[model samples]
Target: MKKVSRGQRKQTKRFSLHSNSFKQVVKELSKTLVSGLVVAVASNFLLQFFQNQFNFEVAWLFMTEWHIELFILGIGVLMMLYIWFTSLIGNRYIGAFLIILISIILGISTQQKMLLREEPMYPSDFSMITNLPFLVKMMSNTIFLIVLILLIAISVSIFWLIKRARKGKKEKKSQHQKEVRGLRIGLFVLSSLSLIYIYAFNSPGNLVKAAYNDHAYWIPYSQEMNYYNNGFVGGFLYNLNVTPMEKPEKYSTEKMNQLLLKYEEKAKKINETRSKSLKDTNVIYVMSESFSDPTKLIDVKVSKDPMPILRQRMEKNKSGEILSEGYGGGTANIEFEALTGLSMEPFASNLSTPYTQIPSLMNHFPSAVSYFKDAGYSATAIHPYNTSMYKRKQVYQELGFDTFLDEKTMTYADTLEESPYISDHSAYQEVLLKLEETDETDFVHLVTMQNHMPYTDFYPETTFTAEGTADDLEAANYFQGLSYSDKALNQFLEELTTQEEKSIVVFWGDHLPSFYGEEVVTVNGKVAMHQTPLLIFSSEKEKQESLGTISPIYFMNHVLELANSPVSPYYAFLMTLEANLPAFEKGMYIETGEQESKLEREELSSETQQLLEEYDLLQYDITIGNRHAETANFFSSK
Candidate 1:
């Protein structure tokens, strides 16, 4: 052994110190990276599980090529965040627990919503935090228990981690801690920048979107499919849609005025042929909740017809179907379309529920209530359910409803057997009461709650049986509810006939009921899945004509036409739209009676396409763009 000099001894110690510091950094980074990898991977899986059937194989089929990259981005973000949070707390275990707990909570919520609504959660949904208590009441006890158990488990885990971390905690005398501090600071900054960049813009050229251009599917008609194609993180980020869409290319005041002028002339031409008017009749619209035709929408082979009266009327009366804006849920959106004569499809993909999402953005509120009120009718809106849902009270008040009645204020707030909602019989009876109260012509819009989700055995006894693995318990229960609704409607019609005033009851199913698997819906066909029964019956006998297929956007137009009612220019445009495009849902599916109902606008006549584009322009102006039509006499009195 050679005797070492003082300088060499110092150098040896310095080298060892640097090497140990490097090892410490590597060790900490490796642990973070591994934990992040597990979290990100598990989160993506949870997202897929939420959107798809819980079956792994089914989820696997929906994964896109961009999934891997999405996970990479998610992992990077999580790891960087873990590193920074751990450094700040000086405890890796606690930080890890916090991250895991938050991610798991989000997953639980997304999964619950997906299972119930068949729609992915959006950031806009968080704004509904104020209604958390009421929403909890709406959830099934099983889901609530699952959430409770998860929270308890996480609490126990966090407690254990805290105790363990505390036991190992020590006062540290630093050995050149500057480099480690520098490393953490860099990570924190990098993480912050990365997050800001990813979330800042929803433009096509955003870094994340550009990188996954191969699978950048923004115009997803089905938001569930959007999540299926995009990984959880990517899909969630997609819902951070600050901009609804780029402004229309020709969205100028002059252009809008010109379009309105053309429609105004069309309205005059339509008015020339009309003899009677909606002004003279009491227009009652019943937007039956989840009141879909299962026999058609799902092709459910039942022991008996669920809605025989509706079917009979469908064959004889001016009845067919309207493309529902929602499936399983989105009753409000369907109502919004029918009430306002605006299509949901024209709005951005993220404006899934316009009643909640887009209403706040509107400076002018126009609906059937406005048109009816203009015609000197007492416009009353009724929903025998939560007043806070979709913020209906505020929306209705703004829409100029003379009276808005919810469950809290309803005269008959009775519920059927085992059902949480008000029964269709009681709901119709409430409408009958409204009709009797007022001698003046009325415009009554009733959104019944008799057929909402969690469709178990609502009816005590039913003869209906459906074809399914579990004998289609949900479908059977739904069919039974429909039977009850059918009886209620028949009774209501009889009651309407007894009334002295001439009246027209426009009844339609908001959307299909929940419980059907996505696979079943897909096999049945998207257009078929979305089409719900639309019946326009009157108090007195009238000519029955098949109106073919149509959408809720054109619903009021049909109502006006069937009633021989005068039309506003806006109604005239919608009438033209229905003529060109008989049925439309989210702009993805269109049914022209001549052609087999197609899923796209690929093979349309040029004139039809132009009309549809004009419809988009009008809808965009109403919801997102300027109120050009408000000034151009588009909604002028007939």
Candidate 2:
């Protein structure tokens, strides 16, 4: 409205230009900050989803609290990457898109790994990504839908960012601005290195200690607990470089030779006193899933002894408690010990499932199957579940199983109404079929799935209900399933009694059911949870014997003793160890004159220590180290 002067008009135009530039700068900074924050939040959500799958309340809360710290770290890293990438590429949108894309992919992959394995992502698991299609098939439709939505959202976000970035005008930067950018990046890198060092090597406080510890003992024995106590990211990174088995002290080829010589001499002495051969016997092992005497639980009473026949047979026959390496889960570990004559106790605690980790790597593992195969026995593995679950199909082949019959190949015709798993009766039928089909002696390992967990309506009408517990449906359901298992076992043994061919049946519960609370394990008593009934029946011999308490690793040795089967040097060593440390699993063991207690190699008797060290070294050589097994024919039957 005032009289227009050239100088005043010029000043007003400059002010307007400066105001618009300030707004533009604010908008660009907002885009960068918002994009970084979005990526960070998405990563946190993905990790939370993984935690939720575990269904650990404490872990969920811990992750919820720890995610804030992770978010902050993620934001800082993304911000630095954004600046550096933009500087390098001169395209802010491309840099942002890459950061988002990589973060999304990694987060999704981590989630998938955790969901499938029930453990955080490890470097070893990267090799299993080829099974992604199978994994996707196993996942629920909900997961696929959510994953699709996530991909779409990310694509849309990338498109918006690209549009905004392309619309931005490029300008020559001043030297001062360039110098400032370089200084910021340098400071950022230094800060990042410092944080990484602290995270990896230092225990600053309780929170940091939980997240990471330099101590070797903090390795993931209980993966769920590790992830719960440590944040997901912390646990995952810590396990990335974990050695599967630490070399035993004083381990060398010379030391190994000396140990083998000592054991071989001992074995020779033992073999001199024996005259036994498994030449004509068909050996059958049924590692029943979640099979245990539930009546052992405190304050629990069922309508009938779920395993009356098994209980009666155990009382009269060669039977005892098997101290399992795992509780509720880890069936493969139990099977591994039984078949390989290697106690898992000596390996890294985090090496939970050997089938997934160790056996898959080798072309031929020293196992009961291999030993039997060498003895002219055809070995067959039968499991009524997906062949790909735990990668058992491949593992069986590596373990020298001539044939693997999984769910797809099984002739099992019936399944329980309440459960998707094949009935135990049907599984036994398949075992009998295999026995009849084989003209030569056979070694059949049948891993049943009828009694597997999530005992949710595993039985349509609960015939055997728990009376003492207040509305414990899970216990009732578990008891009913066990009753069915007992009936199936009785039927199978009865049928076996009719067969004329001499055979040895080794029946054992892999681990206890996870129906009751986890606290029930330690609270009721150690024996109730850790001990499962193990019975070895001989069709030709009627004599009854008792093995007080033993580990699953000694199962085949006991079978050989009962059947007078020829023994390998490794198994001979196992037999001797079993006589001394009769019950030894992961944590607890029973000494010759003492009750079951937590034991360390250092606390063991000198003789026991020497034996365990030799055992550890032998197992490490065969499983993790350069196997020198063929030099001594360690697995060959004498």
Candidate 3:
């Protein structure tokens, strides 16, 4: 052994060097893989924690429940992103920096969305990318600062690691270079495989959905619970499996025509009973943002009644709660349903704002305003807020509104003492101007923004407070806002009575305020969680029978019936559906007097079941299917 030549000694040293280089490369790759796993878990927890209203108990459930398949899928996604970034930048630490940066943004958005929307962020939500600046404002300063600190810390640490790695000596033509290149190439290949396995282009055997089906528990109706049961990455991937609109299996032009023919006859019979017409009456829909009474909420105590005028009106007209599609936000969806008489429960569960989605696709979108516009009424939309809030400018144009008066264009732009938003009284002034400008029959769609979020110390007269809430000051402010809105409505209605023109004011709250904690859900029932006040006030008409709790899709039908105004065959069809089922919203179906929110299809009568099927068919025909129903004059008022 001691008789080795100098050449053999050199060869032995070279072999040892190569082996050491190989071990270093293997170690680096192993470390990278482990890092990806850790980030995946941490990111997933962050997302779930925020989505679940920052409840650590729910976040820890994932760790205890062994959501192994979802965790594996999440790891795959992060590794794929990491590998791509590392390969493109030629720096593993830089790749990590970018990955963490994206994770922070995504986590914050998910949290904010959960707070404002009472649901998880859908893939469709990102389509409203133009509203990013406004959407970002929804995040509280506390949350923003915490996220900023974490992000800056992560970025600096990674930058320092990158600089340190660059300072180390690396040979150009050494075994170390080859080893490094080989490891990166290997990781790149693995990431590619991971992406393909997780998603396979609409394949039923897709791993992302398959994992959810096998391991994760999810509800088709409740999106928030879906995010809770499945982790963030897992829930998002599961939602991705949804279609924008599934064409009904039995959908055909001939079938749509037959249903239209049947509904036309029913409309004729219904119209014969109506006394008055839409000749001189003005149809006005006032959507008060977050206008619900705080006293109705569990554990919320108000010093005095905030909505006396609304309560009085509710008792004297077709009034009750409206089952909202969203809990905390989604004003556009409620407005769309009220205007179009279309139920979102039947539409794909994942569809975002139909104001943008529906109008973008259809050339002939017949809405309540469209019908009124067709019948010699001037359609006017007034909102004392930014026109671009929900893409309302485009949507109002699509709805064939004649005059669109927003915050910038409105006559009255007065703000409350402490609030930055325009007052409801100012919003009502714009409507009065429209009425005075033209004596012709009018349809005004007014959305008020006075009661919008960030309700902190709004009014000096504020006397409302909550004992059990984490934030009593906020609750007090929100209740005070409702009182102000009530006063505005009272004054507006009195002014309407003084005017010569006969008008019908339909007022509703979009949804509950987002400040309510999860404890509210535990105290208040789920069905009650979605309830908001609804009233139809006619200048001349006296008290009518209560409409009871109903979905917004039935809103126009009830309005028409109350006004004794003739309705289109489409409205007649919706009225029939509403009769069978008074409220079907967001996934919960509530019978008029029933407290049981979840009603199974099996519990329905055969006739009601069949009518529901036909309802779905007709909606599909009008919205997603060819213009079979619309062309057949299914919406033409007799």
Best-fitting candidate, scored by TM-score: 3
- How many collisions per candidate? 0, 0, 0
Please name the candidate that would achieve the greatest lDDT relative to the true structure. 3
**Sort by lDDT, top down from the best:** 3, 1, 2
lDDT per residue, candidate 2, 1-638, as tens digits? 87989999999988887676666656655665676566545544455455555344543454456445543443454555555555455555666666656555555655554543344555455555666664465445676787778778877887887777558667767424543455445645654664555344222353434433432235434565565555555555455434568887777888878777877777777777668778888899999998988777776677778888898887767998788776666688888888877777887765656677665554545678877887889899999987876778788888778899988888875888778789899999999999999888999999998887656567767776775543367678878888888999989988988998888899999887655553454467755577788999888876578877688888888778878766778887888887778888655767666675654556778888777877888878876776776567877766
- What are the per-residue Cα lDDT tens digits for candidate 1 across 536-569? 8877775688876788777677677778777888
- Give me the runs in candidate 2 sitting further than 4 Å from their true place: 1-225, 467-471, 525-527
Candidate 2 accuracy as lDDT? 0.71
Better of 1 and 2 by lDDT: 1
Better of 1 and 3 by lDDT: 3
Q: Look at candidate 1 and give me any clashing residue pairs.
A: none
Question: Positional deviation of 249 in candidate 1, in angstroms?
Answer: 2.6
Point out the higher-scoring one by TM-score: 2 or 3.
3
Off by over 4 Å in 3: 1-38, 52-64, 115-117, 127-137, 168-207, 249-254, 356-359, 362-365, 592-596
Candidate 1 residues lying further than 4 Å off, grouped into runs, are 1-38, 49-52, 55-66, 77-95, 112-118, 127-150, 168-197, 203-205, 212-219, 275-277, 297-299, 362-365, 438-440, 469-471, 518-523
